[model samples]
Target: MNLILFTVVATIGYATAQSEQYTDRYDSLRIDDVLANKRLTAAYIKCMLEKGKCTAEGRELKSHITEALQNGCSKCTQKQLAGVKKVIKHLINKENAYWVELTDMYDPKKEYRHKYERELKSL
Candidate 1:
């Protein structure tokens, strides 16, 4: 799983801790809905890859990817972290192409991704 990609999804949540964490504006996002809808998922993937226009949520998620990847999503709330785990699992198990694309974009070194995957596997 790409840690940055996971973190990006994690950024989509409801509001809270804005002073020290990402807004939870997207906290209520139904990850299952997005995962079930290929088109929607592709849109997000495209947005992340700069291959298409970004929705507000997409933009918000993209904005924090670098920092989240570097800092282990320390700013994510519990709900967002849950979303991150779900998205990471989806991308790694279901949307591998996008995962690879995202990994290239945000973690070309694979340093963060490997670390995140190890963490996920341990869980």
Candidate 2:
């Protein structure tokens, strides 16, 4: 009876570990999906920044990406990193352009808009 109980406990522990590993793998795959989709990546980051959901330091983004890569079933390659950078750059450019347009449409009397325009131009 003692041996049987030990075997059952060991089996359960192994299964639990396997389940957690699978979950991690799934999350990594999801991250890869996001990274692979340029439009999705741009939209996600832009929305996060615009909504103030993201920090200015970009630490969260970097950590999330690193974690995903670390837990990923397959390690990320240089090509993947380059692709992510391109997507981020594209999103930043788009956001800058949007700010510029908003600035152009703002009334000169609005000090806030004028300041925002200057900031966008600087970016």
Candidate 3:
């Protein structure tokens, strides 16, 4: 990893700023189901990469990805954070290519990749 429109995590939550934190509309998404479905995962990946059409959730996610990654997702709700962590873990361990692609896109300067990597390893 630069910029991850495919912050896959972004697609999972896609929160909007309302009050002090991000909205919780997508907080109840089933991340496990998404991860287990290759087609769904591919769709998200394509969306993130700007190679395919985005679902509403994907569009929302893409909008906030840079801000979310740069700011450590400070606005995310707890459930969204948990889902993000899970998705990051999956990206790091199983989908390294996508992870790299996302990182390269979102963290082009390598600003947040190492930080996230260390954090994920610790978890």
Best by TM-score: 3
Q: What is the C-alpha lDDT profile of model 3 across 1-123, one tens digit per residue?
A: 224755755655654334657667777778999999989998998899898999887887788888899999997888878888888888888898998999899889989988988899567
Clashes of each: 9, 0, 12
Candidate no. 2 TM-score = 0.28
Return the candidate ranking by TM-score, descending: 3, 1, 2
Error of 1 at 115 (Å): 1.5
Candidate 2 per-residue lDDT, tens place, 43-105, comes to 555543353244332334444443433343233344444444454344335555534333333
Show model 3 residue runs off by greater than 4 Å.
Answer: 1-18
RMSD for each model, in Å, please?
A: 11.7, 13.6, 12.6
Tens digits of per-residue lDDT, candidate 1, 64-97, equal 9888889988999898888888888788777878
Top candidate, metric lDDT? 1
Candidate 1 steric clashes: 9
TM-score for every candidate vs. truth?
Answer: 0.81, 0.28, 0.81
- Those runs of model 1 whose alpha carbons end farther than 4 Å from true positions after fitting are 1-18, 121-123
